[model samples]
Target: MAIKKDMLVEKYIEALESGTIPWEKGWTTTRLHNPITGTTYTGINRIWLTFASYLKGYKDSRWFTFNEISNEKKFHPGEKWHLKKGAEGVEIKKKSIYYNEVEDKWYNSKQYYKKLATLNDVEKEIFKDECKVIGDGKGSYYIFNADEIEGIASEQIIEVDSMTVEKMQTIIENMGVGYEEVMQDKSFYSPELDAVITPPKERFKDEAAYFKTLLHELSHATGHANRLNRDLSGEPGSMSYAKEELRADIGAAFLMADFGLEFDESHVQNHLAYIQSWAEVLKNDKNVLLEAVKDAEMINDYILEMSKERQLTLTQTMEYSALDINEYHVELHGCDEGIDYTVFDNTYRSVDGGIIELNAEDTLLMNDFVEFIANERLNIDFTNYECKKADYEELMEKVETMCLLDEEYARSFNVDQMGYYVSEIFDNGEVVLDAHEDYRMFFTKDEAEMLSKELPMSHVTDNSEFVEILKSNIVNGLQTQSEVNEIYKKPDIEVLKNLKIDKPQINKTMTFGRGR
Candidate 1:
């Protein structure tokens, strides 16, 4: 007996109702659209071009790209309305469509249309505007829609009641430091260990998952300050550290259970799987599930205790002061010839028409002076020092003489009390010593005659003294290098080569006694 068109439509609806629709084997029906008219058409010959256009637009948008859309139905171009056959075939108008694949007596598309027509006004609006009937045959069809359709299609209804803004603010205020602030010192902060809760940028698709991550971080914060004080001493990979991390994980789970935040079977399964893996690592034993549970329970208890205390404190009083830090600039100067110098004062005094001034304190000055001596004396390259090893102590001592001389002379002049006077000198000598203009008269009238007689012009004419100093420094550096080489002996290549050749073979066959 042959199935009627109306009976086939009824069978398709039955299949949909029974959840027996074979979506995986391709849609039993199809849909088509006219791109120029912007009108959709369904039944036997559904235009493929319309379906392709819709798919292209949906795929191109970022919002649609992330969503999962079912592709169970397909479309194909059909004959014009004038095309027809015999009486039964004539009944089959060009618009009259048949299930391209299977025509079941109880499953068809007309029943689905009737069911859709029965929906309430609001539901009907959602279905018509948001849902698409994707099918080709006159008797069978499939439906596809956005994620929003899940709410209507689902057997369960999820009521989303947002947490109050005031409540959220209170939680954050009481949550110690915010995650962003803590992250500023990233070297010390560990998101996994510290369990610092960070609010999601927006609500998540899975609300329970979002809360789980947040609660996990909150559990970590419970260990801080005066509570559990879980060895958050910033030592990476220690047993204590691992235990603390586990405590947070367990605490989060406990909190979720306490708050009545239900999870799907899949979510619960994932959690258990992760916990089981962690347990193996924590105990190094397969049968330690009970111990892990006990640890988790303890962490949960600790969290409850800490949370109560935080709430009490927040209710009593909230006092905080803002700290303001301002930076002040200090101008520094060197000698006239650009010879590096150090200033040992907090505030620099501007002189030489504001061109020269001091830098902040003795520490900076000492550092600058040390750097200058190292650059001038050691002939050490800065880049080499970064990559290669050098004796810092040796370098320090080598420049100690110059450092001491500068310090002593600056002290005698009470340079700290009355800022040192700077001057420029011009002379065609090994060292062009520039005397200050202000102090030049004093030098010429008060001490020039006596100093000139003691250290005559002939003494200034010699260049050998400076050359001798340079030669002595080079010799001392070589001697230091030789001493270092003697202490740490290099490997001997000849001895290693001889040892390799002289090794005896273990498997040589022994001769018989008769042969001997």
Candidate 2:
């Protein structure tokens, strides 16, 4: 059935006048957050984001885009947020599924199915559901977790466990509910003492399947007198029992959405009688759906609000983390930078700026950078906070020097006879390359070839630098290269990943150029 936008708009207007949108009388789901937009996603967007967060082990559920973080448009002027250097984003594809290729048109699912029903046999077969008609156009949103961004604090971040299963397990343990995990077939709740008992996660197919049962029981637990005060005196297969179960079914579905789990309808289909009863009841009454949804929202909200307090309690005992960490203290960085780093603490004390790995990662240095400055509050013993001006200036110099002198750099080169990028093009049409950027010239031929695929059209030269420091970083175990860095070994050229063109198999005397 086609929805008349005008008629629905009129009903919505009436709903506004009457206190609520008629269809949405009790539903306004906004579980996951998009902090950059100060809004929330709905439906599949929510699920995909949640799945990404879980898979990535991101504690903060809020996500932001590259444009929003890099540009000042989303925030107040000069107040742009920063992403940790080298942090990768999760891509969420915007679905354009209604688009049809055959006959070149777009249609809603009902319209497409209705059209297929009217078609002749050949057309019907061509327009079948198995056809790759669901469009996944190039439109996609690349987003970063709030944890990836520097100085972006979020209370929703929970750090008790590594995996979502472990996190949920930890949460359940702390929620003060009577809970037990056993090696049993059935899982259930007892309202008499507000308790839940279920098989451990290992007993189920996966966390999602286990949580499906767990959330159902927890929904029942929400009905205790101290909670939502639900009436739960229903007997087996009784009307009241079905009614309560109906509320749980809806509540489980909502909770599943909030937790980023895909609802498997097979569980419902397996219990055909339960469904038939609900169908009959729904057919006889119109208000049951709204009432169930309202109650389900309440149950979902109760569980989340209660869980958050426990999550925050756990996060407090922890500290900032990353994929890799090398700690730095500004005041203690006056000496040489290494695994054995030392800094002078004669006057002012430096705060712990969290940890950072000092590796010459070319991708992070040359690519778009998120200028992260850790501002973690430290409770160190100090004479005065105001005595940091001169100390900070000297310490910042050391921090910059140490960070710049990371151990090894980007891809290594095995083949010695390859052209490399010597000049880099900037945004304002300026080509710049420092005299001391020797690390950028040590790529192997395979690395050069791979980089050639992504570079813009530019110049390549055969001039080489054999860095003595990078001799150990050649993972390809290629032949011994002539060194020429500070040790001044023989020159070995490196190809730039940003220079567009086929990898030029050139001698030291060769220089190639390209523009497009």
Candidate 3:
């Protein structure tokens, strides 16, 4: 019989109730692999094996299906492989499908089966040319740990090594999140500090396990105020808490898959359990999965974006409050009289620059633009940036109060070719605010300083100075949800992209809470 999705969920729920969550224990420490293929499992299979091995207390992560195990092999030509002598097979549960033709329905069930292998002992002369076979090819496949097979030598089956400590460390360092290794046995993301904490690498069984656990916590870190903004304030075991776990677990899977990391059955099962635990709260909401996937995708992209934005130079290191917004380097690429920009946190303060493609006629405005930015810096603070737009009335008030300009003069300010009037700075250099098409203004501390001293003229219009002002004001800070919302949208998701979706084979009366 094959197992149904609902049954998998139920099993996970039971584990949660019993305080036997696979990830909470040492399941993540195991290095699971497929013996025959000499490859580590990945994605859902990774989670499934993690849970299975932990629950079964299997010491070795090596496993082989019945079809993959053989005492001796007699294939055509020189393509022959042999299994160790006295090798045996064990039965295990696997998913299978069944059809109820009478009711025109299909269902998944769980069943047991035997494994088979053939061997030839030429030295003993018991099976010279002919092969000696053991085990049976029962129905569905059932994976067996190598320990269950008698006389199965270690060399016959491959034991996958975890990724190197250095490699794992490098990946984590580049993930655009703060990471720390502590003496504690557990791992978690501290939203308050926007950092991830975990046990030392040596404490884990291997480097691979260490990274898997780290990835899980890193996924949670994506929900911080500066990142994905996933609400992690829910108390443990609450519906919101469960859902958040699912997001992190699933997000890790998506990331691992994209990074080409090897996952095992335990990964799949652990994630399934997480989903099951929260499925009730997420029940009938088809968008839950979609939302999680988008968040995970954003997290992945953000990591990559940060890596690209990093400009390494031998320089001094400065320390500031963890809550303080750092300087940002905004790179603007010219596109046929327009520009596209990439914004990321600045690691070095002294390195400030921008790329502007403007006609030579705009050169004079550049110096004035630089001075305007300097004066604005004297009067305003750009820390903890906020990305929002104010109404026209509020915009006028700020221009009047901060710039000391009259309403008529402020109203005469030249709108850019894009039709934007004001450029606002938020959180020091974290958020760049301007008049979006919606006519709302972003955070601006000194409206007069940000706006041109000659505001009644066309100085604010599209030109090199205006571009430099915009680039110079770019804030280096963690992107908020609103920032990500503007970057990636719902229309971007291809059917199953950014999600390790489990599409069960069973017939559905209603799939994804919608009639098909």
Number of the predicted model whose TM-score against the real structure is largest? 3
lDDT of each: 0.32, 0.48, 0.44
Q: What TM-score would you give candidate 1 relative to the actual structure?
A: 0.24
Q: What is the lDDT of candidate 1?
A: 0.32
lDDT (tens digit, per residue) of candidate 1 on 244-322: 5555554454555444454344434334423333443433642232233334454555444434322111111112211
50 Cα displacement, candidate 2 (Å): 16
**What's the distance in Å from true for residue 354, model 3?**
13
lDDT of 2: 0.48
- Check candidate 2 and list the clashing pairs: 332-343, 333-343, 412-444, 413-443, 413-444, 414-444, 466-484, 483-489, 483-490, 484-489
Residue by residue across 176-256, what tens digits does model 2's lDDT show?
578888788778888776679887768887767877777778888777766666778888688778778877766666666
- Cα RMSDs, all models: 36.1, 27.4, 24.0
lDDT digits (tens) for residues 1-516 of candidate 3: 333324444555566555444333324333466745766653334444545555556566677765555533521233333434544333333334444343233433211100000222232243221222222212334456665554455533333233455554555565557788899977888877778888887998666677778778877776665554557798877777777786676666545544445666555554554545655554555345434544554554444333331222111121110111234323323343322223323322222333334442333222232333334432334443332211333233222332332222233245434343433333574222232221122223343333333232332222324332322232212343344334322222332232221224111202322121
Order by TM-score, highest first: 3, 2, 1
Residue 39, candidate 3: alpha-carbon lDDT = 64
| Runs of candidate 1 exceeding 4 Å displacement | 1-172, 181-199, 233-242, 265-277, 282-295, 305-516
